[model samples]
Target: MKVVNKGLRAVAVLEACKGVVSLLVGFGLHVLAGHNMRQFAENIVSRLHLNPAGHLPSIFIHSASSLTDARMGLLAIGALVYSLIRLVEAYGLWNGLVWTEWFALLSGAIYLPFEIYEMIFHTSLLGVGAFLINIMIVGYMAHSLFSQETTDNQI
Candidate 1:
Protein backbone atom coordinates (compact mmCIF):
# COMPACT_ATOMS: atom_id res chain seq x y z
CA MET A 1 0.00 0.00 0.00
CA LYS A 2 2.85 2.38 0.70
CA VAL A 3 4.41 1.48 -2.63
CA VAL A 4 1.10 2.06 -4.37
CA ASN A 5 0.70 5.49 -2.75
CA LYS A 6 4.22 6.44 -3.83
CA GLY A 7 3.53 5.34 -7.37
CA LEU A 8 0.33 7.35 -7.49
CA ARG A 9 2.12 10.44 -6.23
CA ALA A 10 4.86 9.99 -8.81
CA VAL A 11 2.35 9.78 -11.63
CA ALA A 12 0.49 12.76 -10.25
CA VAL A 13 3.67 14.83 -10.38
CA LEU A 14 4.31 13.73 -13.96
CA GLU A 15 0.80 14.69 -15.01
CA ALA A 16 1.10 18.04 -13.26
CA CYS A 17 4.36 18.76 -15.03
CA LYS A 18 2.79 17.99 -18.38
CA GLY A 19 -0.11 20.27 -17.57
CA VAL A 20 2.22 23.14 -16.71
CA VAL A 21 4.13 22.73 -19.96
CA SER A 22 0.92 22.71 -21.96
CA LEU A 23 -0.23 25.86 -20.14
CA LEU A 24 3.02 27.58 -21.01
CA VAL A 25 2.68 26.53 -24.64
CA GLY A 26 -0.86 27.89 -24.67
CA PHE A 27 0.33 31.25 -23.41
CA GLY A 28 3.21 31.31 -25.88
CA LEU A 29 0.90 30.61 -28.81
CA HIS A 30 -1.47 33.31 -27.69
CA VAL A 31 1.35 35.85 -27.49
CA LEU A 32 2.85 34.81 -30.85
CA ALA A 33 -0.48 34.95 -32.63
CA GLY A 34 -0.32 38.73 -32.65
CA HIS A 35 3.28 38.96 -33.80
CA ASN A 36 5.24 38.10 -36.95
CA MET A 37 5.61 34.35 -36.45
CA ARG A 38 8.14 34.07 -39.28
CA GLN A 39 10.48 36.54 -37.64
CA PHE A 40 9.96 34.88 -34.26
CA ALA A 41 10.87 31.45 -35.59
CA GLU A 42 13.89 32.87 -37.42
CA ASN A 43 15.09 34.47 -34.19
CA ILE A 44 14.79 31.14 -32.38
CA VAL A 45 16.82 29.41 -35.10
CA SER A 46 19.46 32.12 -35.03
CA ARG A 47 19.67 32.07 -31.22
CA LEU A 48 20.09 28.29 -31.24
CA HIS A 49 22.80 28.57 -33.95
CA LEU A 50 20.81 26.14 -36.04
CA ASN A 51 21.21 26.09 -39.80
CA PRO A 52 18.06 27.61 -41.32
CA ALA A 53 18.19 25.14 -44.18
CA GLY A 54 18.43 22.11 -41.86
CA HIS A 55 15.49 19.72 -41.93
CA LEU A 56 14.05 20.40 -38.51
CA PRO A 57 14.73 24.12 -38.51
CA SER A 58 13.35 24.54 -42.00
CA ILE A 59 10.16 22.73 -41.09
CA PHE A 60 9.81 24.82 -37.94
CA ILE A 61 10.25 28.03 -39.85
CA HIS A 62 7.90 27.03 -42.65
CA SER A 63 5.19 25.90 -40.27
CA ALA A 64 5.42 29.07 -38.21
CA SER A 65 5.54 31.26 -41.30
CA SER A 66 2.34 29.78 -42.70
CA LEU A 67 0.26 30.02 -39.54
CA THR A 68 -2.44 32.68 -39.48
CA ASP A 69 -3.49 34.51 -36.33
CA ALA A 70 -6.79 32.65 -36.24
CA ARG A 71 -5.11 29.28 -36.50
CA MET A 72 -2.67 30.17 -33.78
CA GLY A 73 -5.51 31.29 -31.53
CA LEU A 74 -7.29 28.01 -32.15
CA LEU A 75 -4.14 26.07 -31.26
CA ALA A 76 -3.82 28.07 -28.07
CA ILE A 77 -7.36 27.15 -27.10
CA GLY A 78 -6.66 23.50 -27.81
CA ALA A 79 -3.55 23.59 -25.64
CA LEU A 80 -5.53 25.19 -22.82
CA VAL A 81 -8.16 22.47 -23.01
CA TYR A 82 -5.53 19.74 -22.96
CA SER A 83 -3.78 21.40 -20.02
CA LEU A 84 -7.02 21.60 -18.02
CA ILE A 85 -7.77 17.91 -18.52
CA ARG A 86 -4.28 16.85 -17.49
CA LEU A 87 -4.32 19.09 -14.45
CA VAL A 88 -7.69 17.75 -13.34
CA GLU A 89 -6.49 14.20 -13.76
CA ALA A 90 -3.38 15.01 -11.75
CA TYR A 91 -5.52 16.38 -8.93
CA GLY A 92 -7.69 13.30 -8.89
CA LEU A 93 -4.71 10.97 -8.97
CA TRP A 94 -3.02 12.82 -6.18
CA ASN A 95 -6.16 12.30 -4.10
CA GLY A 96 -6.18 8.55 -4.93
CA LEU A 97 -9.57 8.65 -6.59
CA VAL A 98 -10.50 5.35 -8.23
CA TRP A 99 -11.97 7.16 -11.24
CA THR A 100 -8.65 8.85 -11.91
CA GLU A 101 -6.96 5.46 -12.31
CA TRP A 102 -9.37 4.68 -15.10
CA PHE A 103 -8.95 8.14 -16.62
CA ALA A 104 -5.17 7.91 -16.48
CA LEU A 105 -5.19 4.44 -17.97
CA LEU A 106 -7.42 5.45 -20.85
CA SER A 107 -5.63 8.73 -21.53
CA GLY A 108 -2.17 7.18 -21.37
CA ALA A 109 -3.28 4.25 -23.53
CA ILE A 110 -4.61 6.63 -26.17
CA TYR A 111 -1.10 7.98 -26.71
CA LEU A 112 0.41 4.53 -27.09
CA PRO A 113 -0.48 4.24 -30.76
CA PHE A 114 0.95 7.64 -31.58
CA GLU A 115 4.08 6.92 -29.57
CA ILE A 116 4.51 3.59 -31.31
CA TYR A 117 4.11 5.29 -34.66
CA GLU A 118 6.74 7.83 -33.66
CA MET A 119 9.16 5.11 -32.57
CA ILE A 120 8.62 3.18 -35.82
CA PHE A 121 8.80 6.09 -38.24
CA HIS A 122 10.77 8.88 -36.56
CA THR A 123 12.89 6.61 -34.36
CA SER A 124 14.43 9.10 -31.97
CA LEU A 125 15.89 8.32 -28.55
CA LEU A 126 13.54 10.87 -27.00
CA GLY A 127 10.53 9.32 -28.70
CA VAL A 128 11.53 5.84 -27.55
CA GLY A 129 12.07 7.01 -23.98
CA ALA A 130 8.69 8.74 -23.94
CA PHE A 131 7.01 5.60 -25.22
CA LEU A 132 8.68 3.47 -22.57
CA ILE A 133 7.78 5.86 -19.76
CA ASN A 134 4.18 6.08 -20.89
CA ILE A 135 3.96 2.30 -21.10
CA MET A 136 5.26 1.94 -17.56
CA ILE A 137 2.74 4.45 -16.24
CA VAL A 138 -0.14 2.77 -18.03
CA GLY A 139 1.00 -0.65 -16.84
CA TYR A 140 1.18 0.55 -13.27
CA MET A 141 -2.30 2.03 -13.44
CA ALA A 142 -3.70 -1.19 -14.90
CA HIS A 143 -2.07 -3.22 -12.17
CA SER A 144 -3.40 -0.91 -9.48
CA LEU A 145 -6.93 -1.10 -10.86
CA PHE A 146 -7.02 -4.88 -11.30
CA SER A 147 -5.35 -5.60 -7.99
CA GLN A 148 -7.92 -3.53 -6.19
CA GLU A 149 -10.71 -5.30 -8.04
CA THR A 150 -9.32 -8.72 -7.11
CA THR A 151 -8.95 -7.73 -3.47
CA ASP A 152 -12.51 -6.46 -3.33
CA ASN A 153 -13.84 -9.59 -4.95
CA GLN A 154 -11.98 -11.80 -2.50
CA ILE A 155 -13.34 -9.81 0.44
Candidate 2:
Protein backbone atom coordinates (compact mmCIF):
# COMPACT_ATOMS: atom_id res chain seq x y z
CA MET A 1 0.00 0.00 0.00
CA LYS A 2 3.00 2.25 0.28
CA VAL A 3 3.79 4.57 -2.59
CA VAL A 4 7.22 5.87 -3.53
CA ASN A 5 6.38 7.50 -6.77
CA LYS A 6 9.24 9.02 -8.75
CA GLY A 7 7.20 12.01 -9.83
CA LEU A 8 6.25 12.80 -6.24
CA ARG A 9 9.88 12.49 -5.21
CA ALA A 10 10.90 14.93 -7.91
CA VAL A 11 8.25 17.37 -6.72
CA ALA A 12 9.48 16.96 -3.17
CA VAL A 13 13.03 17.75 -4.18
CA LEU A 14 11.87 20.80 -6.13
CA GLU A 15 9.88 22.04 -3.14
CA ALA A 16 12.85 21.52 -0.84
CA CYS A 17 15.08 23.46 -3.19
CA LYS A 18 12.55 26.30 -3.27
CA GLY A 19 12.35 26.26 0.53
CA VAL A 20 16.11 26.52 0.90
CA VAL A 21 16.35 29.36 -1.59
CA SER A 22 13.50 31.21 0.10
CA LEU A 23 15.14 30.78 3.48
CA LEU A 24 18.37 32.26 2.16
CA VAL A 25 16.55 35.19 0.56
CA GLY A 26 14.50 35.77 3.73
CA PHE A 27 17.58 35.77 5.93
CA GLY A 28 19.38 38.13 3.59
CA LEU A 29 16.45 40.55 3.60
CA HIS A 30 16.15 40.32 7.39
CA VAL A 31 19.81 41.16 7.82
CA LEU A 32 19.65 44.02 5.37
CA ALA A 33 16.89 45.68 7.40
CA GLY A 34 19.26 46.19 10.34
CA HIS A 35 22.13 47.55 8.27
CA ASN A 36 22.78 50.45 5.94
CA MET A 37 20.57 49.30 3.09
CA ARG A 38 21.81 52.01 0.76
CA GLN A 39 25.37 50.87 1.27
CA PHE A 40 24.34 47.28 0.63
CA ALA A 41 22.57 48.28 -2.57
CA GLU A 42 25.62 50.20 -3.67
CA ASN A 43 27.79 47.20 -2.95
CA ILE A 44 25.54 45.02 -5.06
CA VAL A 45 25.57 47.48 -7.94
CA SER A 46 29.34 47.82 -7.72
CA ARG A 47 29.83 44.03 -7.71
CA LEU A 48 27.58 43.72 -10.74
CA HIS A 49 29.44 46.59 -12.40
CA LEU A 50 26.17 48.28 -13.33
CA ASN A 51 26.33 51.79 -14.63
CA PRO A 52 25.00 54.02 -11.89
CA ALA A 53 23.80 56.66 -14.30
CA GLY A 54 21.81 54.22 -16.41
CA HIS A 55 18.00 54.40 -16.10
CA LEU A 56 17.60 50.74 -15.24
CA PRO A 57 20.29 50.88 -12.61
CA SER A 58 18.84 54.09 -11.19
CA ILE A 59 15.39 52.49 -11.03
CA PHE A 60 16.84 49.49 -9.24
CA ILE A 61 18.63 51.68 -6.74
CA HIS A 62 15.59 53.84 -6.25
CA SER A 63 13.40 50.82 -5.65
CA ALA A 64 15.89 49.38 -3.19
CA SER A 65 16.19 52.65 -1.35
CA SER A 66 12.42 53.01 -1.13
CA LEU A 67 11.97 49.73 0.72
CA THR A 68 11.40 50.66 4.34
CA ASP A 69 12.61 48.58 7.27
CA ALA A 70 9.04 47.56 7.99
CA ARG A 71 8.53 46.49 4.38
CA MET A 72 11.70 44.43 4.45
CA GLY A 73 10.71 42.84 7.73
CA LEU A 74 7.29 41.95 6.36
CA LEU A 75 8.79 40.52 3.20
CA ALA A 76 11.28 38.46 5.22
CA ILE A 77 8.56 37.09 7.44
CA GLY A 78 6.42 36.18 4.44
CA ALA A 79 9.32 34.41 2.76
CA LEU A 80 10.18 32.50 5.93
CA VAL A 81 6.60 31.38 6.37
CA TYR A 82 6.38 30.31 2.73
CA SER A 83 9.67 28.44 3.11
CA LEU A 84 8.36 26.58 6.12
CA ILE A 85 5.20 25.59 4.27
CA ARG A 86 7.15 24.32 1.28
CA LEU A 87 9.50 22.37 3.53
CA VAL A 88 6.58 20.73 5.29
CA GLU A 89 4.98 19.86 1.97
CA ALA A 90 8.26 18.38 0.78
CA TYR A 91 8.55 16.25 3.89
CA GLY A 92 5.04 14.97 3.50
CA LEU A 93 5.44 14.23 -0.20
CA TRP A 94 8.75 12.48 0.35
CA ASN A 95 7.09 10.29 2.96
CA GLY A 96 4.29 9.38 0.55
CA LEU A 97 1.55 11.14 2.44
CA VAL A 98 -1.76 11.47 0.58
CA TRP A 99 -2.38 14.91 1.99
CA THR A 100 0.81 16.15 0.41
CA GLU A 101 -0.35 14.96 -2.97
CA TRP A 102 -3.51 16.96 -2.58
CA PHE A 103 -1.48 19.87 -1.30
CA ALA A 104 0.84 19.76 -4.25
CA LEU A 105 -2.02 19.51 -6.70
CA LEU A 106 -3.90 22.40 -5.19
CA SER A 107 -0.83 24.57 -4.94
CA GLY A 108 0.11 23.96 -8.52
CA ALA A 109 -3.44 24.53 -9.68
CA ILE A 110 -3.70 27.76 -7.74
CA TYR A 111 -0.78 29.21 -9.68
CA LEU A 112 -2.11 28.06 -13.02
CA PRO A 113 -4.30 31.05 -13.64
CA PHE A 114 -1.59 33.51 -12.67
CA GLU A 115 0.94 31.83 -14.90
CA ILE A 116 -1.44 31.89 -17.81
CA TYR A 117 -2.18 35.52 -17.20
CA GLU A 118 1.47 36.42 -17.12
CA MET A 119 2.16 34.49 -20.29
CA ILE A 120 -0.71 36.21 -22.03
CA PHE A 121 0.59 39.65 -21.17
CA HIS A 122 4.31 39.06 -21.30
CA THR A 123 5.22 36.12 -23.47
CA SER A 124 8.84 34.99 -23.28
CA LEU A 125 10.83 31.78 -23.46
CA LEU A 126 11.41 31.68 -19.71
CA GLY A 127 7.78 32.43 -18.96
CA VAL A 128 6.63 29.74 -21.34
CA GLY A 129 9.02 27.23 -19.84
CA ALA A 130 7.82 28.01 -16.34
CA PHE A 131 4.20 27.72 -17.43
CA LEU A 132 4.85 24.38 -19.10
CA ILE A 133 6.68 23.00 -16.09
CA ASN A 134 3.93 24.06 -13.74
CA ILE A 135 1.35 22.53 -15.99
CA MET A 136 3.25 19.24 -16.02
CA ILE A 137 3.58 19.23 -12.26
CA VAL A 138 -0.09 19.91 -11.77
CA GLY A 139 -1.08 17.30 -14.31
CA TYR A 140 1.14 14.60 -12.80
CA MET A 141 0.06 15.27 -9.25
CA ALA A 142 -3.62 15.33 -10.21
CA HIS A 143 -3.27 12.04 -12.04
CA SER A 144 -1.49 10.43 -9.13
CA LEU A 145 -4.11 11.62 -6.69
CA PHE A 146 -7.05 10.40 -8.75
CA SER A 147 -5.49 7.06 -9.68
CA GLN A 148 -4.60 6.27 -6.09
CA GLU A 149 -8.05 7.22 -4.91
CA THR A 150 -9.74 5.07 -7.53
CA THR A 151 -7.55 2.09 -6.73
CA ASP A 152 -8.29 2.43 -3.06
CA ASN A 153 -12.01 2.63 -3.71
CA GLN A 154 -11.91 -0.48 -5.89
CA ILE A 155 -10.11 -2.43 -3.22
Candidate 3:
Protein backbone atom coordinates (compact mmCIF):
# COMPACT_ATOMS: atom_id res chain seq x y z
CA MET A 1 0.00 0.00 0.00
CA LYS A 2 3.01 2.30 0.45
CA VAL A 3 5.07 1.57 -2.62
CA VAL A 4 6.66 4.96 -3.35
CA ASN A 5 8.26 3.90 -6.62
CA LYS A 6 6.15 3.08 -9.65
CA GLY A 7 8.79 0.75 -11.06
CA LEU A 8 8.94 -1.18 -7.83
CA ARG A 9 5.19 -1.46 -7.69
CA ALA A 10 5.10 -2.78 -11.23
CA VAL A 11 7.77 -5.35 -10.41
CA ALA A 12 5.85 -6.46 -7.35
CA VAL A 13 2.63 -6.86 -9.28
CA LEU A 14 4.43 -8.72 -12.05
CA GLU A 15 6.07 -11.06 -9.60
CA ALA A 16 2.76 -11.86 -7.94
CA CYS A 17 1.10 -12.54 -11.27
CA LYS A 18 4.02 -14.69 -12.37
CA GLY A 19 3.72 -16.72 -9.21
CA VAL A 20 0.04 -17.31 -9.83
CA VAL A 21 0.69 -18.38 -13.39
CA SER A 22 3.46 -20.72 -12.31
CA LEU A 23 1.14 -22.37 -9.81
CA LEU A 24 -1.48 -22.88 -12.47
CA VAL A 25 1.06 -24.30 -14.89
CA GLY A 26 2.33 -26.75 -12.30
CA PHE A 27 -1.16 -28.01 -11.62
CA GLY A 28 -1.91 -28.19 -15.31
CA LEU A 29 1.18 -30.26 -15.87
CA HIS A 30 0.10 -32.64 -13.15
CA VAL A 31 -3.38 -33.02 -14.61
CA LEU A 32 -2.15 -33.32 -18.19
CA ALA A 33 0.20 -36.16 -17.32
CA GLY A 34 -2.77 -38.53 -17.14
CA HIS A 35 -3.84 -37.70 -20.68
CA ASN A 36 -2.42 -38.78 -24.01
CA MET A 37 0.55 -36.46 -24.34
CA ARG A 38 1.37 -37.46 -27.89
CA GLN A 39 -2.05 -36.44 -29.06
CA PHE A 40 -1.88 -33.27 -27.04
CA ALA A 41 1.48 -32.37 -28.53
CA GLU A 42 0.21 -33.07 -32.03
CA ASN A 43 -2.76 -30.83 -31.41
CA ILE A 44 -0.52 -28.08 -30.13
CA VAL A 45 1.84 -28.38 -33.05
CA SER A 46 -0.98 -28.27 -35.56
CA ARG A 47 -2.60 -25.33 -33.84
CA LEU A 48 0.66 -23.40 -33.77
CA HIS A 49 1.63 -24.40 -37.31
CA LEU A 50 4.84 -25.90 -36.06
CA ASN A 51 6.74 -28.62 -37.87
CA PRO A 52 6.70 -31.82 -35.84
CA ALA A 53 10.26 -32.62 -36.80
CA GLY A 54 11.69 -29.24 -35.81
CA HIS A 55 14.40 -29.60 -33.18
CA LEU A 56 12.95 -27.38 -30.48
CA PRO A 57 9.38 -28.43 -31.07
CA SER A 58 10.29 -32.06 -31.17
CA ILE A 59 12.29 -31.78 -28.01
CA PHE A 60 9.45 -30.08 -26.22
CA ILE A 61 6.99 -32.65 -27.40
CA HIS A 62 9.27 -35.50 -26.44
CA SER A 63 9.98 -34.11 -23.01
CA ALA A 64 6.39 -33.34 -22.24
CA SER A 65 5.17 -36.64 -23.58
CA SER A 66 7.58 -38.57 -21.44
CA LEU A 67 6.71 -36.95 -18.11
CA THR A 68 6.00 -39.38 -15.29
CA ASP A 69 3.66 -39.01 -12.34
CA ALA A 70 6.55 -38.71 -9.89
CA ARG A 71 8.31 -36.13 -12.01
CA MET A 72 5.17 -34.06 -12.38
CA GLY A 73 4.52 -34.26 -8.65
CA LEU A 74 8.01 -33.07 -7.87
CA LEU A 75 7.72 -30.29 -10.41
CA ALA A 76 4.43 -29.19 -8.89
CA ILE A 77 5.94 -29.10 -5.40
CA GLY A 78 8.89 -27.03 -6.60
CA ALA A 79 6.62 -24.65 -8.47
CA LEU A 80 4.41 -24.22 -5.42
CA VAL A 81 7.41 -23.37 -3.26
CA TYR A 82 8.72 -20.91 -5.83
CA SER A 83 5.30 -19.36 -6.16
CA LEU A 84 5.00 -18.91 -2.41
CA ILE A 85 8.38 -17.23 -2.22
CA ARG A 86 7.59 -14.87 -5.06
CA LEU A 87 4.24 -13.97 -3.57
CA VAL A 88 5.81 -13.23 -0.20
CA GLU A 89 8.47 -11.06 -1.80
CA ALA A 90 5.85 -9.24 -3.81
CA TYR A 91 3.74 -8.54 -0.77
CA GLY A 92 6.68 -7.28 1.25
CA LEU A 93 7.94 -5.10 -1.58
CA TRP A 94 4.49 -3.64 -2.18
CA ASN A 95 4.47 -2.54 1.45
CA GLY A 96 7.86 -0.81 0.93
CA LEU A 97 9.83 -3.02 3.29
CA VAL A 98 13.58 -2.39 3.12
CA TRP A 99 14.36 -5.99 3.94
CA THR A 100 12.21 -7.10 1.01
CA GLU A 101 14.24 -4.86 -1.28
CA TRP A 102 17.39 -6.52 -0.08
CA PHE A 103 15.81 -9.91 -0.56
CA ALA A 104 14.85 -8.98 -4.13
CA LEU A 105 18.35 -7.80 -4.87
CA LEU A 106 19.92 -10.96 -3.54
CA SER A 107 17.44 -13.20 -5.34
CA GLY A 108 17.88 -11.39 -8.63
CA ALA A 109 21.67 -11.42 -8.32
CA ILE A 110 21.61 -15.14 -7.61
CA TYR A 111 20.05 -15.69 -11.05
CA LEU A 112 22.57 -13.51 -12.91
CA PRO A 113 25.22 -16.19 -13.21
CA PHE A 114 22.72 -18.76 -14.44
CA GLU A 115 21.23 -16.31 -16.90
CA ILE A 116 24.66 -15.40 -18.21
CA TYR A 117 25.50 -19.03 -18.63
CA GLU A 118 22.27 -19.60 -20.54
CA MET A 119 23.01 -16.65 -22.80
CA ILE A 120 26.46 -18.01 -23.52
CA PHE A 121 25.17 -21.46 -24.40
CA HIS A 122 21.64 -20.90 -25.77
CA THR A 123 21.17 -17.28 -26.66
CA SER A 124 17.68 -16.08 -27.54
CA LEU A 125 15.79 -12.80 -27.55
CA LEU A 126 13.52 -13.91 -24.71
CA GLY A 127 16.50 -15.05 -22.66
CA VAL A 128 18.31 -11.78 -23.29
CA GLY A 129 15.25 -9.81 -22.28
CA ALA A 130 14.85 -11.83 -19.08
CA PHE A 131 18.50 -11.27 -18.20
CA LEU A 132 18.34 -7.56 -18.89
CA ILE A 133 15.11 -7.06 -16.97
CA ASN A 134 16.50 -8.95 -13.98
CA ILE A 135 19.67 -6.90 -14.07
CA MET A 136 17.68 -3.69 -14.15
CA ILE A 137 15.49 -4.81 -11.27
CA VAL A 138 18.49 -5.73 -9.13
CA GLY A 139 20.34 -2.52 -10.01
CA TYR A 140 17.35 -0.36 -9.24
CA MET A 141 16.72 -2.07 -5.90
CA ALA A 142 20.37 -1.82 -4.93
CA HIS A 143 20.47 1.86 -5.82
CA SER A 144 17.34 2.56 -3.81
CA LEU A 145 18.60 0.64 -0.80
CA PHE A 146 21.95 2.39 -0.71
CA SER A 147 20.55 5.84 -1.49
CA GLN A 148 18.01 5.49 1.30
CA GLU A 149 20.78 4.53 3.74
CA THR A 150 22.84 7.51 2.67
CA THR A 151 19.88 9.87 3.11
CA ASP A 152 19.14 8.41 6.52
CA ASN A 153 22.74 8.91 7.62
CA GLN A 154 22.65 12.53 6.49
CA ILE A 155 19.53 13.27 8.57
Quote each prediction's TM-score.
Answer: 0.94, 0.92, 0.88
The predictions' CA RMSDs to the true structure, in order, are 2.0, 1.5, 2.0
> What is the C-alpha lDDT profile of model 3 across 1-155, one tens digit per residue?
34368877877997899889888978887787667777888789889999999998898899878877778788888889888998998988888877788899999999999999999999999999999999999999889889888988999
lDDT of 1 by residue, 45-154 (tens): 99999999999999999998999999999999999999999999998899888888899999999999999998999999999999999999999999999998999899
Candidate 2: segments with Cα more than 4 A from true spot: none
Clashing residue pairs in candidate 2 are none
- State model 3's lDDT: 0.86
Cα displacement (angstroms), candidate 2, residue 41, comes to 2.1
Output the better candidate (1/3) by TM-score. Answer: 1
lDDT of each: 0.93, 0.90, 0.86
What is the C-alpha RMSD, rounded to one decimal, of candidate 1?
2.0
The best-first sequence of candidates by TM-score reads 1, 2, 3
Preferred candidate (lDDT higher): 1 or 2? 1
| Poorest 10 consecutive residues by lDDT, candidate 2 | 34-43
Report the C-alpha displacement of residue 31, candidate 3, in angstroms: 2.3
Off by over 4 Å in 3: 1-3
- Model 1: per-residue Cα lDDT at residue 26: 97
